[model samples]
Target: MLVESLAVLTLALLVEAAIGYPGRVYTAIGHPVTWIGALIATLDRDLNRDDASPAVRRAMGVLALVAILAVPGALALALQAILSGFGLLGLLAAAILASSLLAQRSLHEHVAAVRDGLRAEGLAGGRRAVSMIVGRNPESLDEAGVSRAAIESLAENFSDGIVAPAFWMGLGGLPGGVLYKAANTADSMIGHRTPRHDAFGWAAARFDDMINLPASRLGAFLLIVAAALHPWASARAAWAAVRRDAGRHRSPNAGWPEAAMAGALGLRLAGPRTYGETIVNDAWMGDGRAAATAQDVDRALALYRTACALLIGLAALVAITALALSR
Candidate 1:
């Protein structure tokens, strides 16, 4: 089972990297993440009552998380069971489905768009492109700010959007990937400290942090390795920055990759930034240059691509080892 799971993970990464989820398919049938989001929205509407006590809302949030995971988990298991009977074809189908959970190609495209926007439309274009990937206030950002924000989003999402899902799928196959996506989607939808969500989103936020723990470290390690391979980047600096600054960032998991990318590229990230009217005074991730430009964004993207390639290589290695042991 472990061998099969790792094989599926390797193929899924390859598939997603080759071709991302298509826009036409998304328009026609919606996405797995969107479907999960819709369910979360409904649960929030029906169960997360404004008038309810905090304790009750917290309990309901837990219930909502369970419900959110159960639906997809069961379906993934059923689908896996059915596909297993089909032999190699079943594995391919499962890999295709699992590929949707990852964002390797999409992340690269989005980050590249930020650099393209800056070059083409100046700061305004960069802000517009960066806004799509980050939750921070783009209008408040200057050229350097836009560049840093794009790099930060790329680094953090490298863990959350790529590594985490792949890690889970490599362990538990379809069900693991689906469940991680469901939890991650839930966290993004409702995991805020707002008055309405602080209690209600408690479980989703905490669970996401917990499940992401291993991937966060692994992602930082991959970035470090990629840095070593890059001519201009420094693996030693990346590792040092992770050790020094990853623990200081506001988020438990985001800082790991952000710090590694920052050090690898010799740019600071995740410093104090504004989201709406709110200002988050977080510590800088690296003691490097803070004046990040579109060129810096390009460098970061290169490092990110290398890290992703490393992840695929690791999955392939694991799959091969598992297959050999099984035989």
Candidate 2:
């Protein structure tokens, strides 16, 4: 189990870094997150009835979360048992499945698209590009706002998309990773506090928050270390910002990485922002420049890539250590 787990973690990182989830594969099978999303959506539509009491809706959410987790959890166990028989071939298949659960490449692509859009078409283009990735009101964003939004999304997603999944995979192998993904996908699909989801999505939101706790801190730690390596970013500032500002965000977990990234890059993030018709007066992270530009976005991406590399290297070291200890 340890050997296969280690093998899957290492190869999945390499595979995702190299090609990501191929568009062809996505076109064929949709993505695993999307598949998970469909299930969540189905549950939300069927079970999250307006007539249901708040307590009942919340219970239904818990049941839905359990149902979503059980399917992938069982499959992961089965796959591990079957692969344990085939040796290296089984490990390779497990690695492939694990890679699908990661979002390193996709995250980069989505953020890069925002940068490119800003560069190619100015504020309008940048707003349109960033809107695809963020739930904020794009029309209200200026250039700096758009750039900050992109950087914030990159930082937050790094924790949720990359670090969180890898953290689970190390402990629970492929199913652990998939289980985390399911929780995350459910959170995104139905976890909002709006009238439609506030009650029904309570469980999904809370579960996602609980599962992401450790990875969020780990991700922030990696970003701080990565900042030490970059001439432009400050490790001290990252740590300081994380301590000071992470608690200010609405989410119990997301602010850690966002604050770290903001401090590392010397750019302020998570300030007052518009979300659809609402203006969220979020506390600003990092006492740095708020007027971000395309160059800042690029710099944030550079910091992000370094952080990601640092994370993968650490994961490799952990895998090696686990394999050695198991032996």
Candidate 3:
């Protein structure tokens, strides 16, 4: 099962990486966000109450999740059928084609651009480069702020952008993988405490949290293993630091990898940030060593590259193990 899953995921990854996304009429309509939003609308129709019970809210949340899971499967089957209509091998080629969009190397290079910009042009340049990486307002940051923001985005999105989708897809094929990405995107766009989405986005946020749990810890564990050669990081350092500081953040899962990353890099992450109208004051982690300059950002990138190598290498190892075990 693991071997089959890995083969499928690898094919998908290669597809996305090579040809990239095709701008097709159906694909634009069937993108993950579109489906998630559709599900949210469908789910919200039944729960249009100012006084819905907590039980009712939770039940509705669960129901919404059930629907969200099916959307990816539907998209994959549809895509496969279309590709197969042209030729059976076309379906296989399409799997490889779609994998080109996964963006492993692209993510690394884009993040690295910030560090290079900061080095070449200082804070203003860093801000310009990094604003592209993060969604939050970045116009107001100083050099240190820009560096911190980049590091934080680098660590967190590494989980969502790379690890989580791969993990799910490696387990459940393309449908599972795509749906996980879809769920995460829905949570990011709509999951909030604001009035517009409090109830409507409830299911997405919770389900995203549930789905991210294992991947987050795996991220931390792998970071520890991957960055083992770094002076400040070891398995012990990562484990102790994560246990001590992960609870400091607001999110149940993000704190684990972030704290571990902070600990591994000998820096702090998470604190005050504004998202739109909200001012969220989150607890901090790591030592005050997190007072980062651009130099520290470069070092962090080095660590990240090291960690990424370990992650991909580990994935290859897991694939081998699965194939061996299945035999």
What TM-score do all the candidates reach, one by one? 0.99, 0.97, 0.80
Model 1 TM-score (2 dp): 0.99
| Candidate whose TM-score is highest | 1
RMSD of 1: 0.6
Q: How accurate locally is residue 102 in candidate 3, as Cα lDDT from 0 to 100?
A: 55
Runs in model 3 lying further than 4 Å from the true structure: 11-67, 78-101, 231-236
If candidate 3 were superposed on the true structure by all CA atoms, what would the RMSD be?
4.0
* Count: clashes, candidate 3: 15
- Give the higher-TM-score candidate: 1 or 2: 1
Q: Give the clashing residue pairs of candidate 1, or none.
A: none
* Candidate 1 residue lDDT tens string, 1-327: 998899899999999999999999999999999899999999999999999999999999999999999998999999999999999999999999999999999999999999999999999999999999998999999999999999999999999999999999999998999999999999999999999899999999999999999999999999999999989999999999999999999899999999999999998999899999999999999999999999999999999999999999999999999899899
Candidate 1 worst ten-residue window by lDDT: 262-271
lDDT of 2 at 265: 86
User: lDDT, candidate 3, residue 289?
Assistant: 69
Model 2 lDDT tens row, 10-120:
888888988899999999999888888888888888888999899999899889989889887888788888887888888888888899988888888888888999999
